[model samples]
Target: MSAAPHTPAPKNLGRTALICAGVAMGMTGLSFAAVPLYDMFCKATGFGGTPMTGTAGAGKVLDRTMAVRFDANVAPGLGWTFTPESPDISLRVGETKTVFYKITNKSSRASTGIASYNIAPEKGAAYFVKIQCFCFTEHTLQPGESLEAPVVFYIDPEIAGNRELDGMKAITLSYTYFASKAGQPLAQGGTAPAKGDAATSNL
Candidate 1:
């Protein structure tokens, strides 16, 4: 009457361990691939665009124009042209400015894509830069269609206070563009700082 001889439950320790190991390996693979995947996504969507970080110290003044570059691909049957109207722009500490970029599609086919961007000068990374950016979105342009894109940005006031940034007069913000197979829109080139530029009042 001892419950017909008590029997211990069998433990599938090996199976459990294998399942855990598999999950761990899968996660590791995903982690390892995340950067490349993210790069692909960014290249495809221009999501968040890419930022050009500068080595200039905080609160440092920058008086240089960084070249902005754009990259795009048009379909075989499509012809497209894209350029930044104001590729090279100058900005002083705490001053806000806006630049315009133009894109045109001369082909008979319609083109669509997003335009993302980043700034350069390696020392002016802390400046407050904003793009009326078109990245991470889809834009369609018909034959012979042209559009103007604008980017608004400013240098952080802190730049003037940085000891390393002292005597820095300017910083150039650049953007590179990319187009989708259907003719995605991309930036043209990088921006370079103008020579002998002077710093302005903080904003």
Candidate 2:
């Protein structure tokens, strides 16, 4: 019998090479797209905003003074109460100061929650304020537990010289506690209540 025709290994090899090339191209495209895709994901989840640093001059401006206000709030189901230990307002430029707020759990149930806040005029969110806030992390309180939390923050000196914000006397830094369920902290982006919700306070 004629030697069995040599199997056409080259044909099979060429098809395999094409398949591998397609897969490699696909992977390369995925790698290039990953960064932007991740950025969008973080934005959607609020996972990648400028982090709040509780230091003075972290974002400072030269030759200007900005009045700083410290405001605190609590939500209805937090089973806790909060009050400011220092003057709700102060004046500072290029310097960070710590303000104290007391949190007391009034209910018999253990409560856990986180806090979130924003500055006023929306635009000021970027340069005018810095918060050393507790709600950055979850707080767990036992029944009737009371404790004090401090927020150290400062105003960028630039605000003082900016005519646009010149007359702005106060910027409220408020917090609302949300139930820490499923190990996920509650978020506080909703409209603040006109009156303090049972679980919130504007102190």
Candidate 3:
């Protein structure tokens, strides 16, 4: 006679189900954590266009000058106009400079926006530093209201020694305003509507 087919014990099946459920939960948590963790890594190493944050200016300045161009943008549903006050400026490698960006709400209703920023020529970003910036913060504006935000930054003097950047004469600093709600950027990832008034929030 043929042997009877073996079946998994009830307890074993339950344990297998629990293990699979745990794996699914772990994956979901990782998905939520990926964004913030990537952001932190970029800020720490300037791996992407994200620049390094500093508490103060570079202690020393270099004589070699470089041109820095400013760029600004507003997302489609944000109902805002954003632009850099100055198109471009020159700075010594280690010199600290402050610049302003102008933001105006063109919508009939009040809206909130948060600024995201980055630098161009990825290789050069590692050498760019910011002493102060208005990025990653929420700002709410009434209809037809306007505001001027400032950015303080410098090019690390160490760039002078980086052979790779020897031929780089200019760098671009760009910012994009995205509709925000409850401290989250709606344009990137959020369920909130574009129209809402939010108090100031930080990253």
Candidate 4:
């Protein structure tokens, strides 16, 4: 006949199948890891207008001061009152400081919220590094309960060197709280929050 039609070895077919299976498994794993990887990438590079993250600065606070305006809001469904304790602050670039926002649950039922944050003049996001932020976590409030959420951060000194940001003396850091079902439980055995002095600033 024609050399038995030059049949391929079964072992070769099995090896090819195994290689395809391995590649599929690897792709699945990558898919599972994609979200966390993207989050880390954003926090590191401030890509897509995401803010950068860092620990305490290098202790090289610049002499030049910059205005940091604070703004807070509650998404419609949250049923929470939110406001920045301070309207604005002035600090030297690279100076680390804390700012607090007050959040109060207006609903008669327990509620949970997660805060989303952004810095205006989006170009400054890359240089507004947050060392610690309440936005990184969730908050739960009892009916009529309030809390002072704090954020510790510093403007990267390199921001002062960016020509594009020249004359950008003020940067607004804004936060909005959204209703959530998944958050820490509301604390029990505490007094209900009232409308008075919603936020207190310890900074």
lDDT of 3 by residue, 49-91 (tens): 6788888989998889999988787777889999888989998
Predicted structure with the largest TM-score when compared to the true one: 3
Candidate order by lDDT, decreasing, is 3, 4, 2, 1
Question: Candidate 2, residues 1-203: lDDT per residue as tens digits?
Answer: 67777765575888899999999999999999996687455323323222234344455434444555555666656667877786465555666667787888888988886665545444454444445567546778898898888777766665555688666665555555566665444434534332223232222
- The residue-by-residue lDDT of candidate 1 on 1-203, one tens digit each, is 44587677658878989999999999999999996687565333324323322223233445643333333323233356766664355545545556666778876788664544443344555444443455445667888888887655555665556688675554444443344444334333323222112112121
Error of 2 at 58 (Å): 5.2
Residues 1-203, candidate 4: write the lDDT tens digits. Answer: 45657766687888899999999999999999996798788688766545689876747988888988887766665688988878999999989989888889999999778776666666777888998889737887999899997889888988777897878888788776666545422212232222111222222
Tell me which of candidates 3 and 4 scores higher on TM-score: 3
TM-score of 1: 0.54
Clash count, one per candidate = 43, 11, 0, 0
Cα shift from native, residue 188, model 2 (Å):
11
Off by over 4 Å in 3: 2-18, 188-203
TM-score-best of 1 and 2: 2
Cα deviation at 64, candidate 3, in Å, is: 1.1
lDDT for each candidate structure: 0.50, 0.59, 0.82, 0.74
Clashing pairs in 4: none
Of candidates 3 and 2, the better by lDDT: 3
Query: What's the lDDT of the predicted structure labeled candidate 3?
Result: 0.82
